[model samples]
Target: MSGHLLMGALLTGILAGYGIAIPVGAVGAYLVGLAARERFAVAASAAFGVAVVDGAYALLAVLGGAGLAEPLRPIAVPLGYLSAGALVLLAGLTLLRAVRRYRGPLTVSASSPVRAFLGLLALTAINPATLVYFLALILGRGAEGGGALFVLGALLASASWQLLLVCGGGLLGRALTGARGRLVIAIVSAVLMLVLAVAALTGGSPVG
Candidate 1:
């Protein structure tokens, strides 16, 4: 396969990347919330961090995920459960922190951009279901000579979508500037995360 055939791999990668990310599950919601509450730079870094993880998984899928696919199946669901629990835990913590801040003098509590990036990266990394997803896609398409193209396509695709999310969050942050309003946003964000976690466990999309 060469020429246009290689471009097909890129197209496939783009479609697959969007397919995995478009559902905008727990971690995606968290990213949006983080953006709304914090600086856009921090949120953008976090978005890039998530995209990096997605690209890494895509790379792994194209490289040698086929061998691991069989072994990964048994644990994917269990890890997805753990991922759901993690989302719920994050929701609880988010609501608690928001309440604490709302009661006291308002504080920014802004996370550094680096910390935000690493935080999102680690959170996304724990999602073995994501790995399983890429592996399945690779197995279906049979990534061969176009492995690098696939990775590049996946990386760009996921990054673009995540950045779009950050943009929405940024707009939200601009609109709601009051402490009470921010607190409400946090509560709502927490609720959304909890809801998404339930959906993930109950045969819906996987979440981080």
Candidate 2:
């Protein structure tokens, strides 16, 4: 019975992880862009950071259960707004940097893996989606007998998917290096991110 429960919890966690990670929303857009500019190693660190946060949130959901909603709900809206604002700012900065690169000589600053990890961790943490999603699952009967195993599953699932995105972004970076189309890539990425930001800000799914 214990083994059965553990397996059930692991499966539930995997599903929940994929469910949340599969959505390439504003957060996803930023990660892809980060990977393109920062290389696979740094981006991989960032991806791991995101997965860790997911796992942490999953653990919270299972441990706190329904009680998790109380503290989370009040901050969810604020976090959602803050996240949207940050994305908007990021989109603007991306475009500005792209233009500067186009106009003249641009200096590239190297970012460390640790910095990337912490930056992505903080960025992902601000998104209320991970918390709310896991909380919903808990309330919806998803976390029964779930615990650390569940968090491990969620972390694995999220890590796998996010790393896949990093791979694609790395490939994109390699392809676009010194290519004229790189500018177009920057514009398109920024525009897509901006559009998503607007949608999130105006729509009810800001945190999502």
Candidate 3:
């Protein structure tokens, strides 16, 4: 790829990564919760898990896996609706849990790093929208193999941005350790996730 094209891809990747990562969805909320309950080491592993999934999707997109978009395209509308509904259900559950009387810090089961990694990888892989996003990227860019360097640059940019979000979550978790504080953050984030899920399902105007 030409220097200009590579730079453009890098910038696009950075923007897209931030765009996708910023939304506090199920995974994001879970990450924050994990961080609050565990140390940075655990949180970092979770973050790395997220990054690997994202990078894999980006690579697939750059490799002209636009064909993968077809199967999802036929069902996108229905799936979006279902995703929105699920989000709403999850939000309600979270709210109930937060308000209900409970004791002790939220405890995540102790699992090996590989388990955590696989958990996120599987979660992300099942997300049809992620693959669709990659397909869109491929179509917009014309082919994949032709822009290997640009693709790599974009993937790196995305990975870096996502890793930073994980780090930030770790920091935030440390800062909010009290019971009440954790409760408040969890509730607020759950609400945000609901909003995002609704937006995703409705095909709201693009933010980026």
TM-scores for every predicted model: 0.89, 0.88, 0.68
Task: Flag regions of model 2 displaced more than 4 Å.
Answer: 103-109, 206-208
- The candidate that achieves the highest lDDT relative to the unseen native structure: 1
Which window of ten consecutive residues has the lowest lDDT sum in model 1? 199-208
Ordered from best to worst lDDT, the candidate numbers read 1, 2, 3
Ranking by TM-score: 1, 2, 3
Give the clashing residue pairs of candidate 2, or none: none
Candidate 2 vs candidate 3: which has greater lDDT? 2
Per-residue accuracy of model 1 over 24-129 as CA lDDT, tens digit each: 7877788888877877888899999989998999998887867878877687777778777878888998888778877888676657889878977877887887
lDDT of 3 by residue, 156-176 (tens): 655565466567766776787
Q: In model 3, how large is the Cα lDDT of residue 22?
A: 65
Task: Using lDDT as the measure, name the better of candidate 1 and candidate 3.
Answer: 1
Instruction: Point out where model 1 deviates above 4 Å.
Output: 206-208
lDDT of 3 at 122: 59
For residues 86-170, what per-residue lDDT tens digits would candidate 2 score against the true structure? Answer: 7777788777766767676645636678987897788788977678789888888743665777888898999999998888887
Residue 33 local lDDT, model 1: 81
Question: lDDT for every model?
Answer: 0.82, 0.77, 0.62
TM-score-better candidate, 2 vs 3: 2
